[model samples]
Target: MTTETKPLALTVNGRPVGPVDVPEGLMMQDFLHEYLNLTGSRMGCGQGICHACTVIVEGEGGALREMRTCITGAHWFAGRTVVTVEGHARHDAKGEIVLSPVQQAFIEHFAFQCGYCTPGFVTGATVLIDRLKRKPVARAELEQVVTEALDKHICRCTGYVRYHTAVRDLILATPGLVSG
Candidate 1:
């Protein structure tokens, strides 16, 4: 006798994504990378130490929260909406590729070196920027905010300074982003 599979529904990259029957024990990272081909979220430590598998879950009231997809099960994502680096660009009114301000800032600041940890940083930073939009962080608060947003990412090449600077610069470049 064959057992029936369960369907999971989630939104990805701003689109209605799935009712795919993922196995009961499938990890979110595997479902994302292997099956869905949304590979921007890397599998660095696989145990969630590296934070390279970060993705933004769309929360209520337009909030975006960063989550480690590696240690999470596919079931955890059911009925949730997730955003990856792949969703950073969208067509503007003129049909041109418009990169989100966070993504543009990352490029302008030269935020990455080996490029492995960039996606996670970008994802986390984007969520933090959204959260801080109303409060407007000060220069002193900048470091703390950045540290909290990027505490999980582990980069051996660019080091934390550049990444911290990049996130700070992004917040500074955009008014009303960081808090005091």
Candidate 2:
């Protein structure tokens, strides 16, 4: 008896990659880590609760949402665009990588201890930032908004204060992230 494999073709990290065949029931985490060597999204709880396997998926409407890759099948992402932690950086004209503001914030605030959950936190923060950009939040409601955006992820090292602070700081530092 052999496990069946299915074809997956999707855009990842701003690059078109793969019409690769992955085994049926193969989690996107495994596909990312094993096949693509993208080890940022970790399998913390293996359940969606931890959200250590979060990745951003751009829907047809251009709305980006965080998805748990640990339980998602590779085939589910077929034809969709996904951005992992590696995709969050920008490149300068000289071809140098510039870290995204969220990534820079995390580093500035010392947001992670073991760093196992940083990727998920970063992804979630990026989504929240993007959302806020489209529909700016009020300064008064920023804390609640940040809490709601990041509540799903679990970080054993920093007690989440650092991550929360990092995100809040990022928002505050960026002009027009919130209008109040």
Candidate 3:
């Protein structure tokens, strides 16, 4: 007799993913790093303290909410949507590629030095911008927003000032997307 395995379904980077028999206790980080080869989400702190494992779980708002893929099991992703840093420059309807505004701003501002933490920052910033769009925030609110969103990351090289500048610039560059 053959054994059947349960299937899990998730939408990743705007595409439906999986139904494969993932073993019990397979961490989301392993699924992304080993199976999917999405290496942008780094493994740091391993306990979700560093925020380097940040990845956007679809439908979350404003709070820069993310799932620590390092500790989360793949099964927990069922029926949910996830976006990684690799998806930051997704193709549009016309097949033309577009980088998320946060990514562009990061590039323009030279936000990262070692680049290890860039992915987490980008993903978090993307979520933050989305939230700010719904509820505009002021300039004074910008520091707090950036601080809270990037609180989880550990950038030993850049000191986080550049990342904060980049996010602030992104918001400032687009008044309609963010206030003050």
Best by lDDT: 2
> Residues 31-67, candidate 2, lDDT per residue (tens digit)?
9999999998888998778999999999867878999
Better of 1 and 3 by TM-score: 1
Q: Where does candidate 3 clash, by residue pair?
A: none
Q: Candidate 3: which stretches are off by over 4 Å?
A: 1-5, 60-64, 91-97
Q: In order, what lDDT does every prediction score?
A: 0.83, 0.91, 0.81
lDDT of 3 by residue, 1-180 (tens): 554446778977888888777766788898888878888899987887777888988764424457888889878888888888897796889999898888888888888878887887888888888788788887677788789878777887855888898888788887676654
Each prediction's TM-score versus the true structure: 0.89, 0.94, 0.87
lDDT by residue for model 1 over 1-180, one digit each (tens)? 554557888988878867888877788898888878999998898898988888999888778888898899888999999998888879989999998877777777777878898888888888888888755777787788789778878886856787788778777878766545
Estimate the Cα RMSD of every predicted model relative to the unseen true structure.
2.2, 1.3, 3.2
Give the worst 10-residue stretch by lDDT in candidate 2: 154-163
Per-residue lDDT of 156 in model 1: 66
Off by over 4 Å in 1: 1-4, 93-95, 178-180
Error of 3 at 125 (Å): 0.7
The regions of model 2 sitting more than 4 angstroms off are: none
Per-prediction tally of clashes:
6, 0, 0
Please report the TM-score between candidate 2 and the true structure.
0.94
